[model samples]
Target: MDTSRLLRTTTTVIAAAGLLLTGCTTGGSGKLQTAASSAQPSPDPTALRPYYEQKLTWRECGVPGFQCSTMKAPLDYANPGSGQDVDIAVSRRVATGPGKKLGSLVVNPGGPGGSGIGYLQAYAGIGYPAPVRARYDMVSFDPRGVQRSSPVECLTGPEMDKYTQVDQTPDDAAERAELVAAFKEFAAGCRARSERVLPHVSTVDAARDMDLLRGVLGDEKLNYVGASYGTFLGATYADLFPGRVGRLVLDGAMDPARPSLDLNRDQTAGFDTAFTSFAKDCAKQPDCPLGNGSPEEVGERLKDFFRKLDAQPVASGDPARPLGEALATTGVIAALYDESAWPQLREALRSAMNGDGAGLLALADSYYERGADGKYANLMFANAAVNCLDQPPAFSGPDAVDSALPSFEKASPVFGAGLAWAALNCAYWPVKATGTAKELVAKGAPPIVVVGTTRDPATPYRWAQALAGQLDSGTLLTYDGDGHTAYGRGSDCIDSAINRYLLEGKPPQDGTKC
Candidate 1:
């Protein structure tokens, strides 16, 4: 786990508690139950009827090809008849086809907080394969507490700027105290500002909202393509409504079986793996900033650079802001997301090493989505709120983190300590966790395709394997490549496989290697 991965929430819906189970035992049958089976009413389905039967009013959105709408879901599903309602923002581009339309294909990007509406308009809606786009309406929604939804707002732009610069790899008592204070202030801000919405934005709650969206759209089943954390959310929906699944693709899948601590640790290791790959590639390039050396040597050099920044910050060409260790590490982590960003990262590093930190600072700011006017988006705030409520904190405080430092360091000597400290952000959360880690067998569902990139830095490949194994109807598709995800990233094998599943309802065979 890097600092971003710690604070950022990926979209997934595994119960936070009692997350472990031996194997998939859903419905006692491996195959999907009848579609009619999903219609079986609950003992108290009356409370949900209003939500399930409500009509949607879609209108022209700002984007030329997209339509937008608002729908309401119970703030608390357990008490839908009594609690307040939260608004959901949805966007869609109807299929433009020369063939019969299959249905709506809902797409989600990783941040549990990533705006699905934005993803729909900017990427999946127009950028998806032409055949698939022509046959399936591309759809997306802002999950609760995400942008355009009932978003969770916390620190202001200035406040967030200060928060991001706080020394994560504290070297002394004073620095540690400052880091602790920053975390406390951030946690307190979220509590003060978003109390009502904080407790209800759990992944489980979002999954339930998806169910209502399904009904509102008049779809008998859901067709979805979710990446990174989105995989978790899609799987959770399947777990909650197994009979309503159709053509589900979970790319960069997460293991619902692991606890938060293990997830963080494994993610720490995953980043190390990705960085090593980056380093290996860099060594082959003449302009490598860390020098053309062995991976271990390069790791040491980068660590040394971070250590130097810890003692004395460098000018980033911004009078009020100087490049610090935390910001530099964020810049590094941002590049790990995509190999295409490698050249930019190299330039950023070269600039940083030459006493000019502007490039690196810019990269870090981009990762945090800070604007030129000092305004920050609600992405990080919502990410922390949802992640904290989804699982128990990895550590309670600095003391607990100190005790576990060795394990983390062993996981990734370069990024270990900073990630461990970042994990503490959830410890002081205002709301108690509403869910826990739990197996999502999603039994009695149609075959779900689980895709994994071998060198993905965020969700590890083993997690995809575990998730596939846990889901009774899961089929594993492996992409032996680098980067955070496989599909739609210059991989014909992956795109063809996933596209076929969505357009033709034909999932590729398990263990399909690309």
Candidate 2:
């Protein structure tokens, strides 16, 4: 994840009892049902004890070519009939020309903060192979505290701009004080704006919310594909609802067994791996601007450039938008996540070295989701709130942060320090984390496919390996590419396997690497 556009991934472990809240539904995670029951009236809330709660009614809303509606759930499932309610937003793409559609297939793009509905509309809706989309009604939901289904808001645009620009990796007491003050201000803003919702948006709560979506969608079991942070969300679902599992896919996975500190450090190293790839590729190109040298030399040069920019921002041709260290580092981080953008990165760097930052700025803008009118989306705020609520920050204090700097710098000297600082956003979060680092053992659960890309800078390939090792029935699929995720990144072998599984219930053999 990067600054300005997103912070830490919102997905985290289950919280303590106080911060953790159940979804307003009728079933508990321990056991839902082996399979779908006969089509009948929804379960009675009063009939179920502390576990299951309210019955859901599917209705219609307007979205053209798709069905849209809200599922009424308890604001807190632990107490249903208490006159409190929360709305869950859902959208479904009905199965195309039939084969007696198998069931609903839910997809998440993994921001914990990613817009599930928006991802469906953009890539998964139509870009997914035809055979898969044929037998399954592609569905996506905005989890609690997400975009459509009631969001969490904090700082204003101007305030946010200042927060984003704050020096995270400070060198002196003054700089450290400045950093702490910025964190406090950010925390206070979130506390003031989203006091009640802050404690209730952990990943476990969101995972429970998914089970409700599955039940409401009328699916016998969960059929899902979650990427990046979505992997954490999917695993959490399995840990809680293993019995209700169906065909689930977790691509570009994260290691649930690792703590926030390790997670952030690993991600820092992941970026280093990505930049090494870019450096090697750049050195081979005739148009290389950052000098055609070894990867180490290339990295050092980038660090020098960043230092130069930090001291004196480049012209960038836009007086209103200076190309400072923050923006420059953000631009670099974006390229690390996906190799498809490597060529663009090289070009941007070429232009930047010539004192033109327009190209790099555009790349950074996309990752940040910045609009032209000097306005921004609510992504960053929600990202922090959800993540900070899930688990404690990787950096809790100055000493801990200082200790990790060397390792982070070792990963991608150009990017490590800034990312380490970015981790500080949640250090002063309004809500306390309810979850911790633990393995997700989906014992006796249905087959779950785990995909990894060797050069994925966001979620490392090893994460998929570890996740597959942890899950009782996880099938490993390797993309052998440079990108944040494997699916839809152009691989015939990968697409065909997923299509067969969705359309014919035939998953690729376990440990199949592309």
Top-TM-score candidate index: 1
Candidate 2: Cα lDDT at 370: 62
Kindly list the per-residue Cα lDDT of model 1 for residues 371-416, writing each as its tens digit.
7898866778888887888888888889998998899999899999
**Model 2 agreement with the true structure over 179-250: per-residue lDDT tens digits:** 888888878988898786777677776777788778666677889988888888898889777888888888
Global local distance difference test of model 1? 0.81
What TM-score does prediction 1 earn?
Answer: 0.92
Q: Output the TM-score of candidate 2.
A: 0.88
Please provide TM-scores, in order, for all candidate models, with all chains considered together.
0.92, 0.88
Best-performing candidate as measured by lDDT: 1
In model 1, which regions exceed 4 Å deviation? 1-43
Error of 2 at 186 (Å): 1.4
lDDT (Cα atoms) of all candidates against the true structure: 0.81, 0.72
